[model samples]
Target: MTQELKVINFMGIRKYTSGFSIILTILAVASIVFQGFKLGLDFTGGTQLEVQFDRPADLAKIREVLEEKQLHSPVAVTFGSDADVMIRTQDQMSIKGREYIAAEIARLGNGASLQDVIRPTREQEGFVDVLVINNLTPDQVAQSGLFDTTRFGKTIVATKDNTTQIAIEKGLDLVYSQHLLKELEVATGASIKLRSSDSVGPQIGDELRDSGGLGMLCAFALVFLYVAVQFQWKFSVGALVGLIHVTIVTLACFTFFQWDFDLNVLAAIIALIGYSINDTIVIFDRIRENFRKLRAVDPIEIVNISMTQTLGRSIMTHVTVFLVMAVLYVFGGELLAGFSKAMMIGVVFGCYSSIYIAANATVAMGISKEDLMPRPKDETEGGADLTP
Candidate 1:
């Protein structure tokens, strides 16, 4: 014998829940429109440095020191651990410097390929441009071109003698990696070892941002097509609305709070679209099944019965997922902070939109038994037919 589920009057308070959803959506839209997002280095194109500290790092003091030294708007935050810090700066190497370095390095030899060039701008002696040249030895590079001159001008060889390592101090006025490392060490009173340094051009960052946005739009359109084929156009619209709700609200939280919106966070939002839609699809499936099974029941009653039956499932799924997201948020470190937070918000609102936003929209659109009824073969060819 099957267990009897307690039918919930889900639609009884639909007005209140619908109003709440509308209010949330409106607030979310307003926040996004006004506050915008705090774009990260990945989107805004800047210099990033990762450093490992001998002890726990003090972010505030580090920022203070950088500011006092006038290091061009440095933003410091703990990365993976208290002992690790990542710093981003608006300071970027001029394209002129990069092109000149690249061209000059290529002139050394046919075998010499320019990999990267980081111009150090610190006032410290022996700190200069770090050139990563592939297929070339340090001695070979040291004996040739700018290196031959900079060697006499007091260039420092900061890396081990290898086929790849080369540093040339042209005594340029720009200050960067070595400068930042010295300042951080003095500020935090810890041995600051440079872990990594990277630079992204503004043009590249803009391209990435545009690609991410286009990817999200494609995701929405594909989801609409999927739901339309699997269920019906009415359910498809509802699913789309639900997805938009989760996305906008998630973005709103980030925008209003001024959280860093980077490529990682964008990826999380895309992942959220799938997760939120799964819940919506589950409810839609149940509603379709009940519409067929309970021929005598009204649409509202059918929805309530379906929701009541799936309540246990929805609760279990959301709780399990939420627990996982909580762990990630707490322990996944600063690099994934935005991603995990976005996921956590998605899981919460995913459940809500699936029930209140998606399902309610379908119901309010006057969904009935006939809309989900089995269709003839010709009709089915043109539309969805859930006939078993």
Candidate 2:
């Protein structure tokens, strides 16, 4: 004989779970208030250099060299492999020198050219002109002071239809990759190559940080309106409370671990809001349905029944999302680490809030069968009096 499935009484322990949720929310808020996030280059404005070496790089030596050069608090970390390293510096002081070094190494290799080693800057289109100077001596390339700033800042003229027009003036700080190379004999020594470089100015970084905050605020407002329209104001309040709980706890994870708060992490938090709201809506819908069907049942029993009915679906949904996030966290590397980690934490709390926070808050706010059902029309006044 098959054994019958038991109905779990989730609301039976609402007193305990609700108290636990309140304490957790307090701790999460306290953690966020006390420990601020460690903002990354995407928010703080910095230079990122992707470099590759012939062999595994000595991270300590790289850090020492960068420190000696007075680069701003440079952080060197390995990327996809041990041979590939990514360095982040608070300022863009030594980028030109690093590019010059890579150009020299490329010229020394047989039949190698500047384009073979040095990658162009992302802002190449902004340059007024580009010219290749291939046959300079090694000594000339080594002297960084020899680069003429006037050439970079000069105005270029173009003629068409017998009329002259001025092209955009180039910035004095623009570094051309083609002009940075020279000719030399190949040597047997190991060398590091510059794979890529990216920089964000401080002004842009501040704007991005502000925009991220605004985006989150907008999300909360939109969610509140949607829930209020779709259900009762009580349901909307529950959903908003649940969303706030998920957001604070997710942010608390970042603050407690001192993880990098970048664009990806911000995106993850927004996504968590959507995911958490979706789960809460499912339970709320079930609760509304039960209110109409079980008119004689107590509100607390209806809530427990609704939660129990959706328990299987909730477990399956969150577990699937959790597994995917776990894979991303483990294999997506440092680039996706912050995003996936935030998602993993959010998934756990998202489930918890849907059950304890959203459902419990709805009950506490006095949801009942009458809220979901329509009132009967008056039958006594159905017809007008003929005497009138």
Candidate 3:
């Protein structure tokens, strides 16, 4: 004879767990209200420049250089590797100033081309912001006596039409490459390259912040509608409660830790809503099934039985997801740190909300067998009736 499977009394303990859930909800709300998120460059609006060097860069020296140039509040930090650095500044440099800086970097490297330094923005006429290449060796360029300095002006100017002509006359090559910044590292022994650059305006940042919030609201609204249509209103309400709980708690963690809230983090929050709703719907479906099958059992007992039946599945699913998120958090690097951190937090809270918040909410809203049963058709309604 097989031993009987024991039904865990999950609903029986709801009284205690519900209180804990309420306390957690309150604390999460308080944290979010009191301490706001640490917004990232995507939502704060600033200039970011990524550079790579052949060798590890001296962060302090880089910072000092920016300071000397009067860049306001310039921040330089190591990226994935010591040779890779990302710099953020409140001020955006002018095209002429950028070209001058490129020249300075080329001098530091030994020799570099204009194409190896500044990023070009092509206009209908030609490349508007052209970098002038000093073909002279570092030593010759350093002498500052070979040519008329006044003719070159402060920055190198070149149009698409004259670029090849200028290169031929100057005994230099006019070309373009994504890794022009890397050439700087080769020329002067400083071995630096410009990887990428981005600049965001303050107004654009504000718009992004507002749009992110609106996107989250839209996601929740859609979730509520989907669940309500697929299941009963009570089930939809329970799932919505669970989703809200998970979102609030996740955001609260961000606020409490003062983590950078960016577009990636926003994406993670939307994903959390989907994950939490899926888990809630699974449990809700099981409850509805048990309600119909266990005719003699009380509604509370049926709920407990349903939770017990699905507990193993829930555990396995959450554990698998947690492992993947853990790997991402540990190895995805600083660029993906915010996304992985938010995902990890969401996974944990999503599991908790599905079990405690969603299930308990259904009970509080007075879910019963009748809620899942089909309503009787009205006798007066016109329909084909067949007697077999």
Which candidate gets the maximum TM-score versus the true structure? Answer: 1
Off by over 4 Å in 1: 1-3, 52-85, 93-174, 376-388
User: Candidate 3 regions off by >4 Å?
Assistant: 56-189, 377-388
**Whose TM-score is higher: candidate 1's or candidate 2's?**
1
Question: Which is better, 1 or 3, measured by lDDT?
Answer: 1
Candidate 3 structure, TM-score to reference: 0.70
**TM-score ranking from best to worst?**
1, 3, 2
Q: Candidate 2, residues 98-207: lDDT per residue as tens digits? A: 45534643555443233221223444445443323333343443354333444344433333333322232342123422221111001213366668867788888899
- Residue range 26-96, candidate 3, lDDT tens digits: 99999888998777777777678888878888776776666765655566778779898887765544432
Please give the range of 10 consecutive residues that has the lowest summed lDDT in model 2. Answer: 179-188
Backbone clashes, candidate 2: 0
- Model 2 TM-score, 2 decimals: 0.69
Best by lDDT: 1
Error of 1 at 88 (Å): 3.1
> How many backbone clashes can be found in candidate 1?
4
In model 2, how large is the Cα lDDT of residue 65? 63
Q: What shift in Å separates residue 382 of candidate 3 from its native position after superposition? A: 10
